[model samples]
Target: MAIEIYGIKNCDTMKKARAWLDAAGIEYRLHDYKVEGADPDRLKQWAGVVGWEKLLNRAGTTFRKLPEDDRAVADADGAIALMVAHPSLIKRPVVEYDGGVLVGFSGDKWDEMLR
Candidate 1:
């Protein structure tokens, strides 16, 4: 399957990642969280692979704005629940490529994997 990238369509980081994919002539399909809602089961699977720490976008405004009770998630289940309810809490451009997955984008890393 072609690599599938998940992120908000207008996210700056997502824009950068999309640019790299386009410039590299790579085939990919964007799964915009805004347009297509996230699945809790899929989110859980991603968390299982990369860990909830990597999947959660703690640096984003959405996460920062969360109430203490929501932010005080104690486990993967809590994190995943929040991520599902607030898709913006998800780190941008989670790429499902080949048989593996990449949680964020980097030019060098993309080059390495695509190569």
Candidate 2:
């Protein structure tokens, strides 16, 4: 299966995810948003699969630091706009496998889905 992992390179959770992938011997291409910048089209595709609620990292420092008005994202378009403006608002380690997409890091869930 072709897998692509997206996130900031230095993010702790991202590091764990990368380690887990390596331990599992899963070969994947990294799309580090810190350098590559998150693609709006890909973000929308992921949102379509997982929903914007799951894709948006509201608990992250970047989202929390946003002004009250900016944080009031109410729909997919709004959330997408916010995420495009601030890639850090995206949940870390979004994985796109051939069949589907996975958001966030859950070792058990990834093992179940990818293996």
Candidate 3:
């Protein structure tokens, strides 16, 4: 299966996801959005699948630091713009495998999806 993992390298969740993939002998590409920068088009695509609310990390420091107006309301377009400008506002470790997209990892979920 073709798998691509997108997230910042320093995030604890991303670290654990990477370790899980490695130990499972899964070959995947890691797209570090912090380094490569998030593409607005790609963010929109993900939003379509999971919805912007699920894709945006409201609990993160980046989101908390945004101006009240910026965080007041976010649709797909608005969320994509914000994520493009500040990738840290995105939820951690979005994994795209074959025809599936997984956001946020759980041990059981990873085992079921990758095993």
TM-score, each model? 0.96, 0.97, 0.95
Give a tens-digit lDDT track for model 2, residues 1-115: 9999999999999999999999999999999887898788888888888999999998988988999998998999999989888989999989999888999999999999999
lDDT of each residue in 1-115, candidate 3, tens digit only: 9999999999999999999999999999999997999989888888888888988999999989999999986478888888899999889889998777889978799889867
lDDT assessment of candidate 3: 0.89
lDDT for residue 68 in candidate 3, whole number 0-100 = 95
Superposing all C-alpha atoms, what RMSD in Å does each candidate have to the true structure?
Answer: 1.0, 0.7, 0.9
- Using lDDT, rank the candidates from best to worst: 2, 1, 3
TM-score between model 1 and native: 0.96
Candidate with the greatest TM-score versus the true structure:
2
**Model 1: how far is 65 from its true place, Å?**
0.8
Candidate 1: where is the Cα deviation over 4 Å?
none
- State the lDDT at 37 in candidate 2: 88
Q: How many residue pairs clash in each candidate?
A: 0, 0, 0
Q: Top lDDT: which candidate number?
A: 2
Q: Write the per-residue lDDT of candidate 1 for residues 36-92, one digit (tens) a residue.
A: 988899999998999999999898889889998998888999998999999999998
Task: List the candidate 2 regions with Cα displacement exceeding 4 Å.
Answer: none
